[model samples]
Target chain A: MTIKELANQLNMSTTTVSRVLTGQEKKYRISEKTAQRVKDLAKAHQFAPNQIARNLRLQKTNTIGLIIPDISNPFFANLARTIEVALRKRDKMVLLCDTKDETTIEEESITLLLGRKVDGLLVAPVGEKWAHLEKTNNIPMVLIDRYFEHKEIPYITTDNYAGSYDATSFLISQGHHRIACIQGLVHTSANKNRIKGFQKALADHKVDTAQTFILGNDYSVENGYESAKSLLQAAEVPTAIFALNNQIAIGVMKAINEAGLHIPENISLLSFDEQPYFELLSPPLSSIKQPMEEIGIAAVETLFELLENKKVTSSRLKPTLIPRASVKSIVKS
Target chain B: MTIKELANQLNMSTTTVSRVLTGQEKKYRISEKTAQRVKDLAKAHQFAPNQIARNLRLQKTNTIGLIIPDISNPFFANLARTIEVALRKRDKMVLLCDTKDETTIEEESITLLLGRKVDGLLVAPVGEKWAHLEKTNNIPMVLIDRYFEHKEIPYITTDNYAGSYDATSFLISQGHHRIACIQGLVHTSANKNRIKGFQKALADHKVDTAQTFILGNDYSVENGYESAKSLLQAAEVPTAIFALNNQIAIGVMKAINEAGLHIPENISLLSFDEQPYFELLSPPLSSIKQPMEEIGIAAVETLFELLENKKVTSSRLKPTLIPRASVKSIVKS
Candidate 1:
């Protein structure tokens, strides 16, 4: 039943009936007896106490929009799961939109989220342009996983640069002079930082780079396979390969198997992002574990602060190196 | 700006302003001149047309709730992804609630979804009780993947029984008389049907069942690993195993690795649910591929039907077998 009918029958104003029915009586200084009377009438009438009606007065939908690149990826999926868990505790629900890593879809998601009147937004954006997001004026928002360069928008991401540098240095220390890196989308901030770290490591070691040193335009399993295939087909194949993410790493592994080569024997390998089946893979994989749960928590907390009109700073968590058996020492190489 | 304020400034009713702004002028029988006038004023005033307030009068939120057991599972993630894509096309957004496979959380999610005035609901239920769901009387809802026995609610799911039976029969055909099954939660309708299908296959083949024929009370990777370990340590270990899902199968794979046994060499395995990394695994796992995308589309269509007050019957789609190298033929044995 509509709140208007209930208000008329109860001989009360619409706001009083709405406030009491929504359990916001105390905030509005509603009398206990009046609240109990309203509750009794609401119960008798089987009234749903329309949340939409309450949202009208408060200008708060108590919902947030979450836009991410791909939910099929384990890391992103786990992050969404964790974020949902965290948000639910605070009486906030998320409307998820997957961009499929497309810029056009990402922009559309922003427009749709605004149209839906979500209280805030949590996004792992696919586009390099930050100006498009500024259109969400006065709507609280926080970025996650990936963001644009020079963007002042608050975001939480893994310290990809440090992790990449350490991983590259680890490979160099293993006596591998020629190490190939399978990277993500060329323009992504995460990839840019990773490239910087990789180059810094090589520069520190005085190792000259080849044209084929960095192989990637995307971060799909297919990209990993193709890049690894090309690397292996080279005149002087690298002794080790570093993948930017788990999806790519899995493809690289399959390519190695298809080529009649074994991991850490003919060539060593490493990857970013912790995969669920890592330990189960034949040789096990040495990888960088992005702190997704932590990132999820941070994103929620930051969004909450924004909702409260509090300023939030961007956050970055360190990725831990989970060394297994994929990368090996090349003492003689 | 509020629709009410914009309506007052334009000397138009709130309904007229809302219809024109939301592009429902034709549907609402508003005059073309009046509609154009409302749009011009809305644009001039920067009136975003708050949907929440309009929802009170229209009795439609343009939002749907999605309740799922877990989002981390690849199947469920893909389903959510597909559903989100489908819903966006119809100008609807989904409020995702992951119940963590708990009955209490599922109930809470339902209550919250109702409180949020969701236009409809799509659920992959966790509990056997139907009483909790009956509370959503006027709100349209459709179940996916799981359902109650006596509930009149429409559902869309994979043909679990037929697929399970076929998977089990394939294992039996490979000359593996001793076969084990790694099932999901025992009480779920999907699991119950799968168990029945597995038993039926064994019975049809005249293969004697052992006390350890079925080993599972959950579908987590940890459960799969533990169950496989126990099965492998048994006095009469099975030559083949049928894992209920990919998560369980991955765990089983890990357990086999820990025991220093190779897939298809010591034991063969066939899993339910198609995994993205199936081909990348050492043995290239064979699997029963549930028609997830089809089911997702069907669920959305069914939900839309319910929203339109149209009757929809339950549907179950067949699963296709994707054979790789994980299952071995023991012709000599």
Candidate 2:
């Protein structure tokens, strides 16, 4: 039923009914008992608020577009789920689009979301390009996971540099000198920061860069397999391998087993973003976990602030390590 | 730019430009050369075809709501990504809403999607309730994975009955007399068919129900762990356990490892729906792999057919067995 109809039937003003329906009764000073009665009657009649008309009136779409690179990867999937859930609580729905890690697809999705006139956008972009995204029609937008700090877009992401550095140092402390590193696109800030973290960890320990191998073509399983295959064929293989993400890490494990090596025994392994299945892996896995829940909450908060014309800055949260049995110690026993 | 402006700039009819932009030129006998020219110009200008305006004119949203039960589960994630990719190819966008396996959430999402004037819906509903879904404002809808035949809704799901039957029979042939069957919502069609298959396989082999244990409260990791824990605590634990899904299977693995039991030796395990990480597990799980790709494609196909007012029937595709090393042969070994 329409709010006006409900208001007339309840012998109450339309403003009072609207306030109660939108859960703004506290501001309107409506009694809790009256609010409860209104809600019970509305539920009985299966009343669903017309968000579309209301959106048009407020010059808002009441819809947010969530663009991710890939949903097959649990990291993106989990993040998307969390964001959608959080948005729902704010009485907003999500339009989901995946770029499949292609910059062109991401651009097209942005255009589509804009044409649909979304009130806001939350994106984990595929690349560093931002000149094109500058025209957001003043709609509130927040970046997630990946971002371009050179641009004014507000973002919430895990500290990739710190996460990768800590993961590398942990392996080195376990007496692993020669380690293999997997990388995504070399130009993206996340990749640059991750590589920096890996290299900085080795530099801090006074290790030579020539001792490590930076491998991979993308953040995918196929890249991991190919990289590990040729690396294992080398006469001097590394003692530990640090994968950038869960998808690639799974691929690395397969390649290791195919080469007849045991985890943390012949070859120690590590990855970022802990997944549920990671724990059930052969030796479990030592990996860095991103603060996804906090990031999801922060992204929404930034978008709401932007909606109010408030300035928002890019923010990064710390990543924690959940060490399992994937790393082995070889400290001169 | 607007279609009219683009048409005027190209010295072509607005209808022709619309047809070319919407990939419908060939239907109107428009020349391929002209269509190509139009497409190239559209790409050059980064034209988005104004889906919102078109939706308003046609009294259609030109958007489909995809309501999935869960996305953390790879099965649904893959299916969703595939569906989204396929839908985008047709110039349609997706509104994603996850019920998180909650009936109330599913109902709320459905109502919200309807109120948003969505032209169609693709839902993998939770629970067996259908009366609430019949009032979708006459919007064309298709079911995915989950189905309700009594509601006259079109659906695409894997052949759970045959898949479960084959798995149970294979375990029986391996000399497994005692098997544990984990189910998700026993009253649901999928669980009912799966349980039916298991019972039929046992009856055919003359194995008594007394030799089996039917457990599990839901299709979750926690349920699987608890069910497996209590089952392992029994004086006579089953020789094999057939988990309902991938998440449950992972939990079963954890419970087995916690109880100091080795896979395929102390207890054989099988599950439905193969995930990428399943192979990386300690023993590499054996699973009944559903035709997720085919189901996703079929789901889109059915939705399009419904959009065209074509009568579509619920269809089922076969599941394949990926026999990894998780199942053991106990026959006279």
DockQ of each: 0.67, 0.51
Q: Per-prediction TM-score, please?
A: 0.92, 0.88
- Write model 2 residue lDDT over B112-229, tens digit each, in one string: 8988878799998885677667888778888888787566878899999999999999999999999999877665677878888999999999998898989886788998898999
Error of 2 at A236 (Å): 1.2
Candidate 2, backbone clash total: 0
Off by over 4 Å in 1: A2-47, B2-47, B331-333
In model 2, the Cα lDDT at residue B104 comes to 88
What would the per-residue lDDT of candidate 1 be over residues B5-121, giving only the tens digit for each residue? 888988878878877878898898999999888888777865665567667768788889999988999899999989998998898888899998888999989888897788999
For candidate 2 chain A, the 10 contiguous residues with the lowest summed lDDT are: A50-59
| DockQ for candidate 2, C-alpha atoms | 0.51
Model 2 regions lying over 4 Å from their true place? A1-54, B1-53
- The ten-residue window of minimal lDDT in model 1 chain B covers B45-54
Worst 10 residues of 2 chain B by lDDT: B49-58
Residue pairs clashing, model 1: none
